[model samples]
Target: MSLPKVRSTTVLGVFHNGEVALGADGQASMGNTIAKSNVKKIRKLQDGKIVTGFAGSTADAFTLLEKFEEKLGAYAHNMKRAAIELAKDWRKDRYLHKLEAMMVVANKSELLIISGTGDVLEPDMGIAAIGSGSMYAQAAATALKKHAPHLSAEEIVREGLNIAADICVFTNHNLIVEKPV
Candidate 1:
């Protein structure tokens, strides 16, 4: 029996200018093939207080998002605790551990990456990116944030994703940006 195919995309998140924003390119790919565009890979959680961006298997990501929501509720809307709880479960649960996905989660105060490897990481520079275009987007955002102190968080993420789309074939122009008001 042939195994089901998994899809992936790019996700970026940053904290800048006293704001936190997350962005994602809306392109999905399967084995070098473009499957779809305009996908919403970034989301708001905890009554719109936290923003999360995800990469890797779409199905797995959706499941993780649900699980994360539950965790958030369990932790009383604490972003860090919920992320850590999700990571612990993701790593320890045999079935969940096998799911392929990564997440960048943020609030006005923090930016973090939760991995299947049981890691909940807070980026040193308060910026994080994941997926195929992650390296390119991260580098671009880092440079921009350092050089362009006047840019808003949304602007930095938009430009970062644009740069990633230029370099990564799996990334596209359909972008979604979310931040807390």
Candidate 2:
């Protein structure tokens, strides 16, 4: 008998005010069995200018991040254009097409979400999330936005992380957070 593989999920949230937050459970499990804990799924890229939250195969996520960062570096003056190009490349990249990973990236001016659909998407709601805990995080963010007026971007991210942590054992308080100047 063969066992099914288990994948880890990371949750990320960004607010309109340029504040970003991300969380990943410390637990990695394989079919109801714990595999590894303390694995980090959130990463800071482009000299701390971009925050990435990823879900799916760790290797695939890292590969995407590296490629995106290189592209962003080439077009440092125009981040929006760089993002669009990267998204397009991601969709067409043969390796990326084969992997199962989704990413949510937050920069100073834009929040973009990239899923396996091979399309780069920007949400009208000024926020994007990826990973298994994303649904829970998104719900928490919506509630926070409705009930907590004037909350800072960081505050919203904190709230989102808290929500994710509650449901996922792989997530904890030690979340990797970064902000652009």
Q: What Cα-based lDDT does every candidate model obtain?
A: 0.90, 0.68
Model 2 regions more than 4 Å off: 1-3, 168-174
lDDT for model 2 comes to: 0.68
Instruction: At residue 157, give the lDDT of candidate 2.
Output: 71
Candidate 1 per-residue lDDT over residues 26-108, each given as its tens digit: 99887778888878898888667888889999999989999999999999888899999999999899999998999998888
What's the true lDDT of residue 127 in model 1? 85
**After superposition on all CA atoms, what RMSD does each candidate show versus the true structure?**
1.2, 2.5
Collision count for each candidate, in order? 0, 6
Best by TM-score: 1
Runs in model 1 lying further than 4 Å from the true structure = 1-4
Candidate 1's displacement at residue 172, Å, is 0.4
Per-residue lDDT of 1-181 in model 2, one digit per residue for the tens? 9975666665665665545554444555566676776667767776667777777777777887787778777887355666677777877878767777777777676677776665677765655767666777677777787788588766777777778878765455556555554
TM-score of each: 0.96, 0.83
